[model samples]
Target: MEEILSQNEIDVLLSAITSGEMDAEELKKEEEEKKIRVYDFKRALRFSKDQIRSISRIHENYARMLTTFLSSQLRTYVHIGVESVDQVPYEEFIRSISSLTVLNIYSMSPLKGSMVIEINPNVAYALLDRILGGKGTSVTKTESLTEIEKILLNQIFEKATGTLKEAWSSLVDVSPVLEEFEENPQFIQMVAPNDTVVVVSMSAEIGEASGMINLCIPHTLLEPIIPKLSAHYWMDNTTDERDEEAFQKLSSNLQTTKVDVQAILGETRITINEFLKLGINDVVSLEQQIGDPLTLTINQEPKFYVQPGQLKKKIAVQILEEIEKGVNTHE
Candidate 1:
């Protein structure tokens, strides 16, 4: 199968080299300089760089929201921020994490497939400890979570799904729900090993504990709304004018909302025996004098002082003044 150069052909090459028409060093350098880039078909890129950047922006907002939620719920200082967003093969994503960790398989409705939220064991244990009235610290090692730990984690992440929904609201209205839980990453089979996924890596610091939280969104799950992830779509919808309009609409609806209002004439404490012996015609003394102002309450909150009076033969209470601000008038 090898073709060898004839003596006359080789002699021609030597003549060309000797005549300065060809340089042997230049030929060798040219062969060495040829660049060959390898492309693997299985690890193909499914998301464009622009789309990846958009996803990163969405998760950045998610990180801030999660930080606030966690800090408030745990009553500790929590900081979370987006570390990176990358598109890689599903198998590579799964292999990068620990074998034993918290895997929350959740579904984003209106999308066909499910997504995953992988929590490092340290972070999970830290949160669990904080929730159970301990300092936010984790053990040096980790193991599979118990049934009670799983239930608490479920509740925590179930509430966290709200932040995910809000983050994607600018692109699409997605209701994410926790569907299943697994400790081993290999047990997750939402997508094929060769499938492409966009992973959002976040660095979370909760009190004394710090670790990474990863959100793996398979390409198939985003394929349906891929067009909405464009920069143009995001820019057009997330305008200040749209937000102002929504705010005005909400304000208008609230202005017309009805609330319960009650007027309290006075209060008096009576013995159980006296209360049982009271009759319809008997008069009982109240704490307030005859001309004392009555308290007006709205939605069970004491909000104003009023005067009990009569208008057109109907008893009514007229608002005298508002209760002092920032003071608990309920007492």
Candidate 2:
């Protein structure tokens, strides 16, 4: 039942309209222009656009590293690239992928909670086929992966974590340890249904088979380092002097790495017949003369000029000069 307008209200409305105090069309236009945005609390955005962009850049590097690693391991042309990075509800992420796909739940230590790496069934099977002595071809199988197949898949995920670590090293040093594997998404409850998760969707093409790889990183696990996931913070931390401890650690590790060094007397081009007819103690004339400095190469790159000599009754080469770039090593 509509209540009738009182005489005073009617008189004011009519007077306002007639006296040009209030325009009826203007009031209607104002009402029509007002907008109301519906906000869903379940899908609240926890990460800002800056943070999302930083995460996208980090995973872009991850795709390149994973592509190289997968190509070498699978012995096939594997192309992986970042398709989209978005923040969505945990339940939405879980429901977006296959029902019986491969879910690798892993822990990023020094940061609380666990994350997920969801692999599409087709891509997973193609990788499994390649590893199991078959061509890299995907098969549509409904049954869950067998025990042996799971073992092989686990190994692949474990090695892939190394690339993950390197990719995140620029933002945060994280050790991604695979905790468990699950076939059913509902069985795994690492994050709440309402919790926000940043999902890095990557398009992967291994040989002829193609699929997606979703990396669901929970907000809780990244809360501590959320500040680091900003363009400003990333730019500020780009200098080497900011991370002196890491630099020192890298220097110490490099000290222990062994590199091959060869002191070459000289180089000379010879025909296949000359190489084939060469015998032991054959005096193949070199391009260098006696008392001339030798080229000391490290890891196949000419780096130094040295003089051959005897030290403590053993053959040795004394460093004479450092080889500059574009210098002729034969001279």
> Which candidate comes out best when scored by TM-score?
2
Tell me each candidate's TM-score: 0.66, 0.68
Ten-residue stretch with the least lDDT total in model 1:
234-243
Tens digit of lDDT per residue, candidate 2, span 1-331?
9789999999999999999999999998887878656789998998999999999999999999999999999899899999999999989988898889999998988789998999999899999999987888999999999999999999999999999999989988889899999999989888788999999999999977999999999999989999898787887777536578888999999999999999998778899999999999998888888878988999999899999889999999999899999877555
Best by lDDT: 2
Model 1 regions lying over 4 Å from their true place: 1-36, 239-331
Query: Please, what are the lDDT tens digits per residue for candidate 1 over residues 3-91?
Result: 89999999999999999999999999887878656789888998888889889988999999999889888999899999999888999
Reference-based lDDT, each prediction: 0.89, 0.91
The candidate 2 region of ten consecutive residues with least summed lDDT is 235-244
Supply the global lDDT for candidate 2: 0.91
